[model samples]
Target: MAEITTHQLVKEFPGGVRAVDGLDLTIADGEFFALLGPSGCGKTTLLRTIAGLEAATKGRLTIGDRDVTELPPGKRDVAMVFQDYALFPHMSVADNISYPLKIQRVPKSSRHATAAETADGLALHGLIDRRPGQLSGGQQQRVALARAVASNPTVFLFDEPLSNLDARLRLEARTFLKRLQRDLGVTTVFVTHDQAEALALADRIAIMKEGRIQQIGSPREVFARPANTFVASFVGSTPMNLHTATVSGEHVKVAGSSVPIPPSARSRVSDGDEVIWGARPEYLRWSTEPVEDSIEGSATIVENLGAAALVTVDAGGTLIQLVVDEDDEPEMGARGWVVPRIDRTLLFDGASGELILDDTPTSP
Candidate 1:
């Protein structure tokens, strides 16, 4: 129900460790936004800072329209769900859900009634009297969400809430969480290291690293056009294949092949320049026969992925991966050609590791 905005937000530790460094961001009202990065990448700290659990070292934080930079967690009107689905071990499900309302001094009758209604909505009405120890992991997670919903806060913050669930249950809970957020329409910020989780759940994602944001975009935009090498190497199920190559005319020499510069990077490249060329496995063509501008290599390894397989080929000491139908998976050591898609290929500056996405090159 509220948009969250931060201007020059900073959270630093006593030892000069800057967990979140002068980051500026805005999450739209009722938007599902995610903070994605590797472990120890300040995502949790950032989430905690927004929740008022960790005070900000500098800058401003506003929820909806109020400047809440100096407010306590209780006064911020935000609900947070931690990775472990922190529930009261001794309290019954209904009691746990109604605890926040009780702290607000709501009448016992009214708070219980509200808790019952929220529990029913999350399919936990039947187990309202069960303690946390009696519930399954998935049930505990729902109880945590029910507790947050009972408060009806303007914003929701989640710190890897699905990490405790088993894989199958995680998938189910993911769908459930998405639907829950859509139905309630609360502005939510989720922090996680899982790329798939971020991709599947977020309306927009802020990709972070070392306490700084690297890119912000929709799922498809980040996947198709990564802002830089770090994002290109991190956003996909199988990270994009990135390799160093020397520019020769309009082509880059790599993997024992001369691949044309991608349309997006053509005007940014020149002869004798060293660049990092990249392509996702999903975008490359698989062939047993030789073709134009194709990488020639022998299949070194094949990884089965349900209906498809990731084929790793050794091309003149450089490894290139391509996804092929399970039926078309090549035998080990089979010779083949994997062609990088001309239009979809990516180029990054060799020294800067910055994506060369525009006409103006980054080199001298």
Candidate 2:
């Protein structure tokens, strides 16, 4: 296993489009790191650059202790699993898994033995004789993973390797993949647009936007304490509700209602500063009567999700959402109050969209 590092990495395409822009990152040895972002965010371009499939426009690329910026894909000591499971249609499972060994000029008997061992680990033992065309989608994905594992490369690169699977299969594959990666302890770099997949599979994730990294942290850190408004809105299961408000002493005025700012955020802005107040759906509590430090709103929609209900309220012109227990479902068209959990509230600078740090009491 090897650590991958990049410094000032850049990849610019024709028409003045920059896919990856001056990214500085490091993936530790045996670490499972994920690159997550929306479509056209340059995650795939960065992965391709790491695999030597795409040349970097400018920067240094290193694997372990060697500089590999100019090296070709074959010499990078990395194996990639593509989204489409790029397996040979005519090759049997065993043959496909052992193809890397063949290319390295290993003896046929040794290749078969290694293939068998890898196949058994991935539960593909009985499908050795089947070709890609005859295998199920999940089975084919396993074969692809088996092939990649059989190579025993220093690093594994996965470009949405489970995107094509059904929801159930995807969950299963995620669990299996995590176990497999743990067992092998090889450094892995995964690229995906799925936030849940990244959160579930990665030890650390780098969220990207417009070819630049927005935030890098553990899943819980990113989800619970987003660095800025973009991350606060992007990483949650339900997008965070953000509204423009004016700071007044220790409180902010939201839709003509005064809401106390969390003690943690008290010193971030002056009394007249305009800031964005953010709260996740789960952090908002609903009540029929006006409550302390709450904004009154009219419930416009109520969606009954099996375990919980989503209550969307219109507070003046701003829309807010609250996730409540099914037993506490609110009636649509009813006027109610939505109170944010002060401890969990977030404040962002309106002009810059940057998080406003509380710097007040040193500890929470």
Candidate 3:
């Protein structure tokens, strides 16, 4: 396995459309990194460039210690798994997995042995004689993975390899993929638009937008402390609620209620300055009785989600969402108050969408 590094990497299509723009990143050796973003965010383009399927417009790329910026796909020492499971329809499972060995001119007997070993590792030995058309979607995906493993390349590139599976199958495939990567310890890069999938499978994730990386961190870091409003709204299962509020001394006025700012964010804004207040749904609580730093509202919607329920409260003009216990369900149209956990609140600049950091205390 080898580490991948890119410096000022760029990929510009015709008509001056830049898919990947001036990205500088280093993925460590044997690391399972994921590139996550919405559609048309240059994630796929970046992956293709790394695999040598697309040439870089400008910059340097290194795999291990070699500069591979201008090398063709075949010379990159990389194996790619496509979203559609690009297997030969007529070839048997064994033949498909052994195709890469054949191209390298391995003896037929050795190729068979390697194919059998890889198949057994992936639990595909029993289906080796079946063609792609005769296998289930999950089985086909396993075959594709086995084929990638058979090559034993220095790097593995997956472009949404599990997108076609059903929900339950997707979960199973995710666990399987994670285990496979751990066992092989190969440097891998996965590209996907699914945030949950990235969070579940990657050791580190780079969130991208408009060809530029927005943030790179562990899943917990990005989820708990988002770098900005974009990340706050994008990374969570339920988007964080944001509202414009005016800083009043040590407090911010929200929906006519004065809420104290966390001590960590006290020095970031001056009195009367407009700031954006952000709180996650799970961090807010709903109650019928008045609570400290709470806003009164009428319940607009209540959704039961198995073990928990999501409550939406319309406070005058703004809508706030909070999670409640399933046993204590709130009735729609009931008047209630929503209280935010001040320690978990986030503040952002109203115009820039940048997070406001507290200044360090001066030593006396």
Which has the greatest lDDT? 1
| Model 2 lowest lDDT segment of ten | 355-364
| lDDT comparing candidate 1 with the true structure | 0.92
Question: Per-residue error at 209 for model 3, in Å?
Answer: 0.4
Clashes of 1: 0
CA lDDT scores, all candidates in order: 0.92, 0.91, 0.90
Candidate 2 stretches with Cα past 4 Å from truth are: 359-364
TM-score attained by model 1: 0.97
Error in Å for residue 342 of model 3: 1.9
- TM-score between candidate 3 and the true structure: 0.96
> Which pairs of residues collide in model 3?
none
- Model 1: per-residue lDDT, tens digit, 100-167? 99999999999999999999999897999999999999999999999999999999999998999999
Compute the lDDT for candidate 2: 0.91
Considering TM-score, which of the candidate structures 2 and 3 is the better prediction for this target?
2
Predicted candidate 1, C-alpha RMSD: 2.6
Winner of 1 and 3 under TM-score: 1
By lDDT, rank the candidates, best first. 1, 2, 3
Greater lDDT among 2 and 3 belongs to 2
Which lDDT value does model 1 have at 23?
A: 94
Q: Which stretches of candidate 1 lie over 4 Å from their true place?
A: 359-364
